[model samples]
Target: MPEKRRPGGNTGVWWRLIQTAARAGEDMFVAPDARSVHRGNRRAPRTEVFRPCLVGRPGGDPDREIWEGIVLDLNRYGFRIRSFAPFVEGDLVTVQLMRDEEFKYPLSGVLTARVVRRSEAGGGLMDFGMELVVEPLSPTSRSGRGIRPAPPPSLSRPGTRMHLADYISKGRGNKNR
Candidate 1:
């Protein structure tokens, strides 16, 4: 067997090479690329828009303690969020989306996900990266069939009933409609 090399033994060499190459590239009047280096590695495209949401731990008092957040970006398999609540790595949480009626895509569902990464995002907020915990239905490759629809906004709030006519009237005066 070949001799096994230890990790981190030559870390500085790689850094030096990168720095020198970057300096050389800059000297050649090359413009810095605006695209991310990870562009080609993503499973799906992400929209750079914020969607309102509520995130909470399973079986917790969602009305009393649920943290409001914005879904920063999402792909086919995972999502990133900026939340008021702190989530530890490996915690399972349910994400409920607050739909915007003006948007063309109708978002309705509670997705169960495992928190794979978390970091402090300043101002007592946190950033989380969660992977969807979808269970395959059978021996075949059908996935994500187990996702459940989110609870209605009326249920989220206690003793508040919304009328459909009231909702429709609010949009009548808006120019976007």
Candidate 2:
């Protein structure tokens, strides 16, 4: 039997409808950012940061070499940093949070954290999510007594500011004295 053709040529109505639906779906459902995927109901809350930081790994030797990074977010135990240097999961790292002009807080020490996740940020840079292998002890804990008091547990809470003494750094690596 011969096939019958439509009165006019196929304008691709079905294809057009599918395309339109796909476009609508794309618009309605946007993909979440890299941070969103890793930080699902985190045990510790993270606060957005604009502070400059140094993230370094052992370079050939145990001595730590620095890489410039912007601390995107931080908690007491971990941090999410963006840097041009790439770090792989389970890699150990050290961090030094540079003093900001606005806050003027000096924080530096060997973190000894394990990289939990690494996501590429555009422009040859990557974002790293690090979890501290061991929670840093307050300076006072080492000295037995410190002149400064410890800051409140929550850094993200409104009206709470971080103090120089509040910064935690623990364990000595070959890089750090």
lDDT tens per residue, model 1, 1-177: 997879868877777666655654222222347432312224555655588777888775646567778888887787888998768999999888787734334376778989987878899889998888987566333563654668767645467787976678677865443
Model 2 reaches what TM-score against the true structure? 0.49
C-alpha lDDT of residue 31 in model 2 = 41
Off by over 4 Å in 1: 1-41, 60-64, 100-106, 138-177
Query: Each prediction's Cα lDDT score?
Result: 0.72, 0.70
The per-prediction CA RMSD against the true structure, in angstroms, equals 23.5, 24.8
lDDT of 1 at 92: 92
Candidate 2's displacement at residue 96, Å, is 0.7
